[model samples]
Target: METVFLKKGEDRRLRIGHLWVFSNEIDTKRSPLGSFAPGQSVLVADCGGRPLGTGYVNPASLIAVRMVSRKADEVLDASLLHRRLSDALALRERMFRTPFYRLCHGEGDFLPGLVADRHGDHVVCQITTAGMDAHTDELLSVLDSLLHPSSILLDNNVASRDLEGLERFQRVASGDVPEEISVEENGMSYAVPLKNGQKTGWFYDQRVNRAALTPFVQAQQGCSVLDAFCYAGGFGALAAKNGAGKVTFMDASAHALSYAKRNAEQFGTETELLQGDALTLLADLRREGRTFDIVCLDPPAFIKRKKDAKQGLEAYQRVNEIGLDLVRPGGMLMTCSCSHHLEADALRGLVTRAAGKRRRHARLLFQGFQGPDHPIHPAMPETAYLKTFLFHLPE
Candidate 1:
């Protein structure tokens, strides 16, 4: 195996358990990064030539090295893949009652750049790293032999592939994938469009947060509810099924609205699906003097890049303020942010600022992270990104 030597003081992150080794940190004079091929396993050593760990080197990317195993003697092979997959499945079985959940959550599960989500007998896998991409055949074989998933769908359409110098494509890696699959969450059924849906067809990360809204929802029975950015009607359908008098789902995607309608129909709940931009729709609702008993704000990542942090935070504050304004006095507001760039404290501050701007006293009733299916790595704070907070508006 080849070796990539780091300069003095450059292995600090690796020692501290952070997996990424940037290209700039390498000792180019001793071993030029250009010589290494993408996804090639190499022995990483410190300045004194002491072995550090076994990792894959991607010279074309900024994240030059992604640690595969800390054990010096460990080899990256089929046996290792089997062990990692089994360990990941064990954790999921212990945490989730149903088989439908995030089976793997990238670095959080100690398998960097690999995500596996299971929906019944089907498994949707996404490989976001060159290292994982290089091992697709091994991964597929292992998954087939071990899980025997009815099908394995590759949803590798993420833009992150560009940064890794990879081309993005989607295909069924093994077996046959059905047109649509149903997965139940918190007693609600949803039809997931795996072949052409967002982020593996469903947002399983919000399962716990959506379940947490049951209490607030039950309390507001027979009251009108507004579910903004209601993808597939997870929140809106839940509210309606929980006995909300009525539910209105607003989103910019017509396809998402269609899925939301289908979900509502499956639950036999009456829902009003509106297709449009959330911010514009909210403004119109406020102008029309519309007020809902429960308003849910589950928008997409407002801050995708670090440079957009400021403007994105402002956008969050604005939407949250609109959501608060649309709620009747003493109503409930369930707001969420999936932006890893925005910390929980910063999001709380945004909500506080929104409440102050609206001149309404907001009392936080509940706060939560992503569902148990998406476990957080102690060393990788970025893995724990989702934040949902429920608030009570003063009457």
Candidate 2:
């Protein structure tokens, strides 16, 4: 195997099990990166000639190397893919009673830059790395041999692909997938549009968090609920089904609000879907003097990059303040941040700052991470990103 040498003391991240090797850390003079192909597997070693691991190198990308294996004899091939995929499946089966869950969560499952979401008989896969992109055929065959879902759709429109010099496209990979499919989440049925929906048609990561709201919903019957940044009414629908007197969903996407309405209707629950920006909607609701007994603020990633951290924290604080203001005294506020860059403590601080700005005291009730299906990788902290906090506002 070809070898790529890094400068002395530059293999610290790889020694600690982090998979990525940045371009700046490599010794270009000894092992010029331009000679390596995009997805060619190469032995990674330190300057003193000690083998670190075998990883795929991408000369065109800033992430110079993505480690595939630490063992000396291991090779990146179909057999390795099959073994890793099978191991990922075994872990999920042990944790979940149902097949409807995330099958592979990129780095979390040890298969970097790959995601697979299972929807009963169908599986949606997204490949975002050149290494994984080169092995699409092998991956499809492995998925066919293992889970054997009725169909597999490749949702490869993620923006991360651009960084790896990949084109964006979505198509049926294996079998014919229907436009609409039904899956059971937390014992509730939701009909999702796979071809025309967001992130494999469902947000399975928040399944556990949505289920946690049942108790709060049941206790606050006849109470008005507001689900801001609601996607397909997951939280609002649950609240309505659990007996919220009125559920109002606010989302910027008309398409998302449409799905939310369909979900609410399918579940025989009534929800008012408002199509508008979450921040603007909150301001409008506050001006209208409309208060809710329960408010859920589940926004998308406010901080996509490290540079946006400060602005994103302020955004979180502002939206959370709006959410707290709209909540009736003694109501519940369920806030969430999907930004992996933002730590739980940072989010908690933002919530506290928002509460202080509103001159309200909030008692922490519960906090949660991503669902079990999306397991956290011990070596990579980025795998465990989602954070949800439930607070009780004083009357």
Candidate 3:
């Protein structure tokens, strides 16, 4: 195998268990990135020619190489994929009773650039990196061999794929993909649009966070809730199931709202669907003198890239402030951010700032994170995204 050597001291992070190797870190004079194919496997080494590990190199991407194994001889083949998939499945099975969870969480599962969400008999997978994309057939085979799911859909319509110099497209790698599927979570069944839904058809990362809001909803029987950015109404369904009298579901996609409505109906809860931009709808709701006992602002990642942090923070603050204003005095607000670049403390600070702007006093109630299915690699802080903060507004 070709050996990609890093410059002096550049292997420190890798030595500490980090999995990424950037293009600039490579000792190009010895092993030019251009010499290797996008998904070519190679042995990574230090400046002194000490082998570090095995990984796939992507010359066009910022994350040039994603280490697959610490052993230099480990090949990126079906055996490796099978072992990784089996390990990931074992973890999810241990944590959850039902077969509905994230089966593989990219680097968190030691299979970087791949994410697969299991929904009962169906599995929805997304591959964002060229390295994983190259092994599509092997991944599907391993998944089928392990779980024998009814279907496996590759939802590779993510923008990050473009960065990897890969074309974005969705296809069924195995079996037949149903139009819809249900995943049980926190004693409730959520309707997921598997074929044309967002981010592998469901946000399994927020499973734990959504479940954490139950007590708050149950505290005030018949409390009104506004689930902003309610994709498929996961949060709203939970609130409705827990004796919430009224639940308002809002989202930009009509398709998402349709599913959200279906979920609310399934729960036998009264729901109002608002289809439009969240910020505009939120502002309009405030003008209409509509306030809810529980306001959930689960917006999309406002900050996707590091460069967009400033602008994204502004959007977060504005939406959070409006959400705070729409909360009834003495009610609860469940706000969340899925941006990996945004830290928990930073989110807290922004929420504090937003509260001050609205002249409201909030008592921090609960701090939430992604479900156990999405494990965090200790060396990689990037794996620890999805911050959910629940606060109580004093009367």
Q: Model 1 residue 299 lDDT?
A: 93
- Per-residue lDDT tens digits of candidate 2, residues 251-354? 98887888777766664566788888789889998999989899999999999989998899888888987888899998999999999999999888877888
Q: Using lDDT, rank the candidates from best to worst.
A: 3, 2, 1
Top-lDDT structure, candidate number: 3
**TM-score of each prediction:** 0.97, 0.97, 0.98
Residue 83 lDDT, candidate 2, scale 0-100: 92
- Poorly placed runs, candidate 2 (over 4 Å): none
Q: Give the Cα lDDT of each candidate.
A: 0.86, 0.87, 0.91
Worst 10 residues of 3 by lDDT: 260-269
lDDT (Cα, 0-100) at 80 in candidate 3: 98
Evaluate model 1: give its TM-score.
Answer: 0.97
Using TM-score as the measure, which candidate wins?
3
Task: Give Cα distance to truth, residue 383, candidate 1, Å.
Answer: 1.1
Against the hidden true structure, what lDDT does model 1 obtain?
0.86
**Model 1, span 241-289: residue lDDT tens:** 7877788999998888888878766655677888898999999999999
What lDDT does candidate 1 reach at residue 361?
92
